[model samples]
Target: MLVDGHHLLYRAHFGFPRRVTGSSGEDLTGLFGFVALLRKAHREHCPGQEVFVVFDAEDGAADRAENVPGYKAGRAGADHSPVVHLPAVKQALDAAGVRWLEQPGCEGDDVLATLAKLAVVTGREVLVFSGDRDLYGLLDGQRVRALNTQLPAGRQLVTAADVADRFGVHPVQWPDFRALTGDASDGIPGVAGVGPVTARQLLAGGRRLEDLPETASGRAGTGLARARAQWQEVLAWREALRLNAHVPVPDDLLTGRPTPGLVPAGQLLTEAGLW
Candidate 1:
């Protein structure tokens, strides 16, 4: 199982309203929730699976930001609650003896995607745990599946069929899908007036945006026509949105070394002086 480290950490920080505090009144809610989440995933979904967590490097998205103005710019000004607790989260991971990695220029999504591909190539099944829909693009029916522990049905896996059923696009086409419709979370401004329904229509029949005529009639066609001038930009967005499944991960990392046994959540907090 591959986990999106920061995604789950951020979710845990915001999901819990009660502020768990330490001796100096420092917030421990994020730490507590993060540990609990990992424990839950371990007890329920990870008993037999080799678990690895991937975090986005501090400057992971710098390239994308430079290429596309306003790329995740909003987050730059947002509250720091989500990342402030990361140090503690890492501490807990160390306590649990879990495996994780953060490369200088790679986002967690790309790292997870790369690891997933490597795992699949070796005939191992891959399950990605992340709240970020961007990883949905990494799903492959036979080998890869995505999961969001934040969901009410936390253990329910998202497969390629689910992507097709929900979004009218195959998992492989997810980047293109978002490129046309725009990913609001990342501040991608897709062609104005183009929405999911139209984007879906344009991308139907396994035809990519470049495969279609630049000019045509009707809503989907008109949207495509209007986007031609910005095709290069859109293409860049597609690349930005696409997960780099080839991020150089070492072969040894795939061997799943024996992690130290997990420390109980209560013990972890008590040891950290948060209890």
Candidate 2:
């Protein structure tokens, strides 16, 4: 199983109240929630399967920001007090024998994607845990599944068929859809006036943003014109937002095993002062 560490922790930090703290008098909402989520995920999927937690290294943010000046700019200067105990979280995971991967110039999503792709090639069942909808594009045969945390039920299991049913387009067309309908969260400025409906229609017609009819009639026509005009910018942003799985994974990083042991939840809570 591959876990999007940053994505899940970020959500946990904001989803709960600010009162959650650790033994060091530091805020532990994110840490506590993350541990719980990890335990739950371990129980629910691949009980004895090996797990990899991927974290975003600091270097990648600069590249993403450089690619699009406004990419994730909204939270650039935000305070991270709520997640101050993240180091403890890492230590906890380490104690629990969970292997983690963090590579310079690569985000957690990239690591997750790379690991998932590798698992597919090895014919292993891979489950990705993340809240980012963009990862939906990675869903495929029984070999891979995406567990999105933003769904109404707390998680949405995504497969190839689920992708087609939910978005009316195949997983491969997800980037195209995002390119036409901007994602405000990611600061992707998609074609103006083109929302999901129009984007879906254009994608369904088998036309990329660059190939849409410029002066045609109806919503599709207007959407095509907008897409054409903003094609370059949108494409650039898409490239920026897309996770690269070609990142070299060091054999040591992938094969490292944690010291075997179970981290008692009570001990973790007490040491962290959550008790």
Candidate 3:
């Protein structure tokens, strides 16, 4: 299983209260929740599966920002206290002997996407442990899926079918879907007057954003006329949402199999002096 480190770390830090702490009185919310999530994932999703965690560097999304100045700018303006717990989480991971990476100039999603693609090329099936909807674009259905342990409705194993079933689009078209809808979370202001239905309609029939403008139906689409007028921005958003499958991880790390960190998380926490 591949993990999105910041995604789960933030989820854990926020979902769990600040009530927990280590022997030294340092906050242990992230450590506790992250370990529990990983432990449960191992028990329920992959008892014998190897686990690899990918973390975002400080400027992981800089490349995207270069293309679009506002990319993820909201995050910079949001509360950053959660990142304080990253070190403790890493400590717990190390204590558990889990393998992880924090590649320079790469986001966790891209690294996970790259690894997932390579794993499939080697005929390996991968389950991604993340709640980031953006990762849905990586779903290959047969070989790739994202497992979320954070959902209150209960954990869900999301495949390409789930994306299609939920959004009327397949995994490959997920970038296009995001393009039309825009992700305010990332500060990608979508086309004006456009939402889900209109976006789906524009992207329907296996047509790309660039081609949609040339279609008679697209030129005459009833809703989101302003968005249609701003098709160039939607296309740009789609390209930004597209995952890069060539993030260049070390070949030595692709061992064709993952070696799970089976040491009980409780033991790891204790070893970290957090229990």
- Who wins the TM-score comparison? 1
Backbone clashes (count) for model 2: 2
Tell me which of candidates 2 and 3 scores higher on lDDT: 3
User: Which portions of model 3 show Cα errors greater than 4 Å?
Assistant: 152-155, 213-224
- Model 3 lDDT per residue over 47-146, tens place: 7777888999998898898987799998877777778878777877777778889989998888999999888988889999988898998898669989
- Each candidate structure's TM-score, on Cα atoms with residue i matched to residue i, is 0.92, 0.87, 0.91
Clashes of each: 0, 2, 0
Order the candidate numbers by TM-score, best to worst: 1, 3, 2
Ten contiguous residues with the weakest lDDT in model 2: 254-263
Enumerate residue pairs that collide in model 1. none
Off by over 4 Å in 1: 213-216, 257-261, 272-275
Model 3 is weakest, by summed lDDT over 10 consecutive residues, at 214-223
Q: What TM-score does structure 2 among the candidates reach? A: 0.87
